[model samples]
Target chain A: MDLGSINPILLVASIMVSATPILLAAIGEMVVEKSGVLNLGVEGMMITGAVVGFAVAVNTGSPVLGFAAAALASAVLSLSFGVLTQVFLSNQVATGLGLTLVGLGLSALIGKPYEGMKSPTLPKLDIPLLGDLPVLGRMLFSHDIMVYLSLALVAAVWAFLKFTRAGLILRAVGESHDAAHALGYKVVRIRLMAIFFGGACAGLGGAYLSLVRVPQWTEGMTAGAGWIALAIVVFASWRAGRVLIGAYLFGGVTVLQLNLQAAGARVPVELLSTSPYLITILVLVLISARGIHGAPACLGRPFHASS
Target chain B: MIRLEKRPQPSQLWTVLTPVLAVLLTMLVGGIMFAFLGTDPLEAIRTIFWDPLFNPQFAGFTRPQLLVKAGPLILIAIGLSIGFRAGIWNIGAEGQYIMGAICGAGAGLAFYPADSVLIFPLMILCGALGGFAWAMIPALLKVRFGTNEILVSLMLVYVAENLLASVASNLLRNPEGMGFPGSRNFKQWPAAHNAELISGTGMHWGVAFAFIAVILAYVLMSRHIQGFNIRLTGEAPRAARFAGVNPARIVILCLGISGALAGMAGLFEVTGPAGQISIDFNSGYGFTAIIVAFLGRLHPVGILLAGLLMALTYIGGELAQLMLGVPGAAIQLFQGMLLFFLLATDVFTNFRLSLGRKEPA
Candidate 1:
């Protein structure tokens, strides 16, 4: 029952690390959705990135290369999904589920040799002036490069969607692919690019998990984080700024639950562990109940042009 | 350059041919994958696709095991196919399955040491109800609030897993087992055990129910107005709305049926084959059923055949692992490839390949 043992500083620092993966994934998925493509295979791409990232880091003794390899491998994997759903005009929901199956199975096969293996973890990058400060420095300034990169990514996505013409076209494509097609915009090409970007971002997030978060390779390690990211996208209403808030909110719940267990709180361990998922469902219900349905109209619809 | 032209209507020939084509394509590609893995591709392929039911050494035991494996898959997929037909996705059947097993097992355990004839039937009812209740969360939410059922249902899977872990360890733990986390074995409890009706045939109550479900689903989809409504809703929602189809009722019905079936599958597995409720009791039957539903083309008879084929792979994959040391994950990869090829080839059903540049209409 001793709640005082939980340090706010360590909690805040860990929240940044824990939130970074989902933040990266959610922001990327937001862009993809904005382009009117719903790629539900974030879990699949993330797991692929995790295994590739870990394998590369272990072999090369470099986390950066691991991250790059993860992004490349996941982006390549996502293109298969792109080809299937975009070109073949397959049902996006079913195809996305198939991608997850493929990714999970493929990652398991590729990760066999690396099971129970450790990888080179990203070192903390302490900002100069801020790192010297008291509580705020320890909480925010002292973190890995991925944490800051994830934040910058959110801001960058926000600006891109708000001010850029390309972003507007992407949005137009998402809102109504047929209308975008009538405007002579390459709807399929734009969607494919968005899907690729989403895959790469999901991969980087997964790489951060293996290379920095857990610092090891484990089968099925992503373990529904990708789904959580997808939920966060809905929770954010596809806005990049709110995506950051949603990821942090989820991350805070996760970290707090772990801290409670560590401190031997009276609450049952299972209850604490299940809180994040339940909270996500609660948040989704609340958001949807507000009647602010901001989803792209063309989301999850197959596009085929015949002129 | 190659181009695709939309057909006036979907081809009936391709509808039946695509699954066959997808299987062959998977075998070819999967063989190459096996070759890269250092196993003799032909041997691995034979072991996976042939040896389970044909090999003299394994057929006697594996034949019955096929029914045992396929029973839950077919039952769950039957329910899922109905929902999928109506375009209502209840991906959280896994959670419902878990809840069903827990509730069914818990109900049976409540009457421990009592040899009543009613125990097993009561358990089945409880199991279905548990699953139905679990599914109602997403169904109710989607109906009332316009929430995304996919995300909500998926999140519940994790929650269900945690609940399973908790109950297996604490609430349902066998008191006399001295520290092991599991329920009392149902096999030893005669009144509650879902035993095979015929010895050595693997024809348990679950298998019997699955067969019944297949026939019932076939009737419902082909000869019933509700089935017509479900199909109409998916094909043309605005048309369905104009025709006075109650979309909310359809959502509730689809989710409810799927959840209940998935739950019963879990209950049957726990009582018959699984023997006891444990932390790892689920074993992905709910998720794999999704693949079975798709591979069967969301049709009842198709799901029956698809379920059997999928079960053969499960048994054959085990045999392959034992005989050739092929990694267990290879079978999963194979199934995934099958789906991909099916989806890829599905284009032929709606479009024809044009070899030359498009002509003015």
Candidate 2:
């Protein structure tokens, strides 16, 4: 009931922190989708990244190495998906689901020994003069390395998709893979690369959850963040900037729900907790009703070369 | 250079043999994985695939336990296979299952201390309806707005899990049990209890329903118009449309049947083996059903066999954990491999793999 109890600065900071993982994952998935590939194993890849990141950091005493290990391990795992969908011409949807189940199970298996273990903390990057600013500085400037990197990644993707020839080729492949193949663009190869990039990004997001958010190894800790990130890609209409907005919006709901619980609001805690997912679905449905603008035409379709 | 040449028609032999091949590949690969984990590969595989059904020491209990474990999986998988066949992916059957359990348990709890002959049937109806309503969210959204059902349904599972936790803690908490977060044990409620119909055979109402579903589904797919339309839609959407088959009706029918079946599964589990509504009531039956459906080639009979096989793994997984200290997650990884290997080898059904220079376009 007390609006004054909530701090705007802290809320902004929390939103940034909360949104980082999804932003990273969605951004990567956006690239993959742009190349006309739909890899639904974000959850699996993220959880794999999470456990690997946590285990490496704890054992190596280096958070940076943990993040690297996460990216590498998840990317390696994603290659199987690439081989299945791209090379074997398996159904993309089924393969993605397999990736998720395998990733979850594999993460759980490997994470067993590391359960209850604490991870090395990732240091926040406090820019010299801006860190002292009352609101704007704390809201935007003060964050860990990954948050800033994620923001830069958004900009880089936007530019790449708009300007770079490689990005154009990716988009070309996504829009019409058969046409792209006719033009000698190597549709499968491009998609394979995009899938790997998505895997790495998903891994980083998982690493963020383990290294920064929870700072512990637990089974299913990434929860449904991977799915939410997938939804964000749709909600954003495959736009980079909109992805940032969507992630923050979703993150705000998550933070607001927890804030409601902390403030002892009259609403049931479970209802508040589910608000993020409900809102995502609502937004997704509303947008899709009107129809999407930039969805990859070949999204989720498996590519086979020989006719 | 290897090239895949599309066959004139999908090889029918591979269709039957692929599942068998996938199982063998999974066993070989999974055995190697177990070996890496320091367990004897053969012993691990034997324990997981063999011990539960034939081991003299465990058979007395494990034999009957297979049906108990397979009932929910078969029921849910059968439901999912219907939707998946029509390309209407309802990945959130887990959520529907949870809602069904909650709603069914809530319905039964409302008439607590006032037993009636009608209570059990009413619970079944409510449970199925509960799941139906829950599933309608994605169905309606997909129908009305063209939203993707996969993400929406799957996301709802987390929401349902939270709701489950909340309900178990607050609304359904057993009042007489000193503040425990569970409902009244329905096993003790004679009118509500889903007791085993056959002595020591684990033939509860759920198992019977699973069998009934298989028979009905088999009949429907082979002889019914709706079943033909379902298959037609999956194989050729444009042709189905050309034949005046209503896509919207198919979506609703598929999602509805799957949701209702999943709901019933949840209700049976809550009332029978589980015996109460608790926070941890869901043991991933919904998720596991997806694997079962795929493993069974989305066929009713295949799902029945796949469900039993999956259940065997579950029972054997427990045995592995007990005997060799193998982690539970490893067993899950092994089960997931079944689906991965299935899909991987499925390539041979439609195209033959050849090693040569890439075929000229």
Candidate 3:
């Protein structure tokens, strides 16, 4: 009930850090969906990245290498998903669910040795003058490399989808794979590449969690952040710019709730823990009528050239 | 280059064969995973696939647990299969299950120290209504705003879990007992206890309901007009509209029925095997039932058999974990493999693979 107790400066800083992961994942998934592929295995991919990132960071003592390894590992896992959904002509829904289960189990199994292992912290990039700015510095310029990278990735994707010929082809394939195929675009190839990029971004998000957010390895660590990312894509209406807003909004909710809990506010723990999700759902319900109009026409539908 | 040619009709042979093939492949692949972990591959596989049912040392004890385990699985999967057939995916059955337990158990606990026979039935009704109401949120949203049910349902699971933890730790914590994070043990209460109908056979009220559900589903799917609408809607949405099937009505009906059934399953589970509302009561039956629905090809009879098979793995997987030192996560991986392989092999049901095919330009 009391908003007075919350520190806006620290709150904004925390939101930036927390939003980075969801932003990375959502932005990645946005590209994949733009290419006309829907992969529900974002949660699984993120968790794999989390564990691999944590394990590698703990072993090699470098968060950068850990992030790289996490991305590579999840890309491999997502490749299996791409193969099953694309090459084998399986139902995308069922295949994506299976991928999540596999990712969770595989991450848990792989991380068994690294249980309770501390992750090497990701270093924050501090611009000499920008980082010293009065109010904006702490909120924007003072974050780990991943936060800036996440913003950069969003801008890059926005530019790619808007200005580049490849982006046009990706959007075309998403609009109608048949037409794209008729236009001599390798629909499956474009989709697979998008899927790979999506996987790598999701991995980066997971790595950010393990290396920077919590700075440790824990089972089930991602804790539905990947799902929030999925919802954000829809909330963003598949636009790269809106995706940033959606992630930040969600991240703000999460941090605000935690701050409420920490400030000894009388709000029950259950409501606080689940408020972010409930708020996201509420937002989804509000905008849903207008939301899905921008979704890729062939988003969840599998492509088959022979058909 | 390889190509997939659509068959005029789905192959009947592969429908029944895919689950079996998937199981065999899981064993083969899972065994390799176990070997990499340095366990004896054959022993691990045998332990997971064979020992619990056929091994004399474990069968007497594990056999009775199969129904106990499969009862809720079958109940939930039957509901899921119904919705899935109508192409309305209610992925958050887990949340429904937890809510059902809370409402049913909460109602019973309110009447503690009373011995009325009507209490149990009333609790059952409350349980069903609780789940139905929870599920209706997503159903109505989809019908009204065109929101995706899958994401909404899935998000509700985390909400439900938090609610569960809160209830156990604060709201429903046993007052008489020394500050514990669970409700009063319903199994020990005479009026609310879900006692087994046939002693030593695992024929509790839940198991009986599961059997009745299977029979009811079979009849409805085979003889009912509503069932036809559901099947038609799933297979051909446009054709169903032409045939006078109402999509919104179907969505409500399917979600309501599935939610009610899942609620009953949770109610029965809390009262019987689980004994009370605890912080970590849910064991992923809601999620696992999805695999069962798919593994059974979304058929009633197939779901019944698939439920039993999945239950066998649950019991056997624990046995493998205890005896062979196979990690718990491996069993989950194996279950996931079942769904993946099932979907992979199911491609053959609707299409034929051809080699070096060139399309006529």
Off by over 4 Å in 2: B355-361
Off by over 4 Å in 3: A1-5, B356-361
Tens-digit lDDT track for model 3 on B176-214?
Answer: 769989999997898999988888777788888888999
Report DockQ per prediction, comma-separated: 0.80, 0.84, 0.78
Question: What are the runs in model 1 whose C-alpha is more than 4 Å off?
Answer: none
Q: Per-prediction TM-score, chain A only?
A: 0.98, 0.98, 0.97
lDDT of 1 by residue, B306-326 (tens): 999999889988998898999
Worst 10 residues of 1 chain B by lDDT: B352-361
* Number of the top-ranking candidate, with DockQ as the measure: 2
Compute the interface RMSD for each candidate structure: 1.2, 0.8, 1.1
Sort by lDDT, best first: 1, 2, 3
lDDT for A99 in candidate 1 is 89
State the lDDT of candidate 2 residue by residue for B137-180, as single tens digits: 89988888899999999989989999999989899888897998
Better of 2 and 3 by DockQ: 2
Query: Clashing pairs in model 1?
Result: A36-A174
Weakest 10 consecutive residues of candidate 2 chain B by summed lDDT: B352-361
Residue pair clashes in candidate 3: none
Candidate 1 chain A weakest ten by summed lDDT: A118-127
- lDDT at position A189, candidate 2: 88
Considering lDDT, which of the candidate structures 2 and 3 is the better prediction for this target?
2
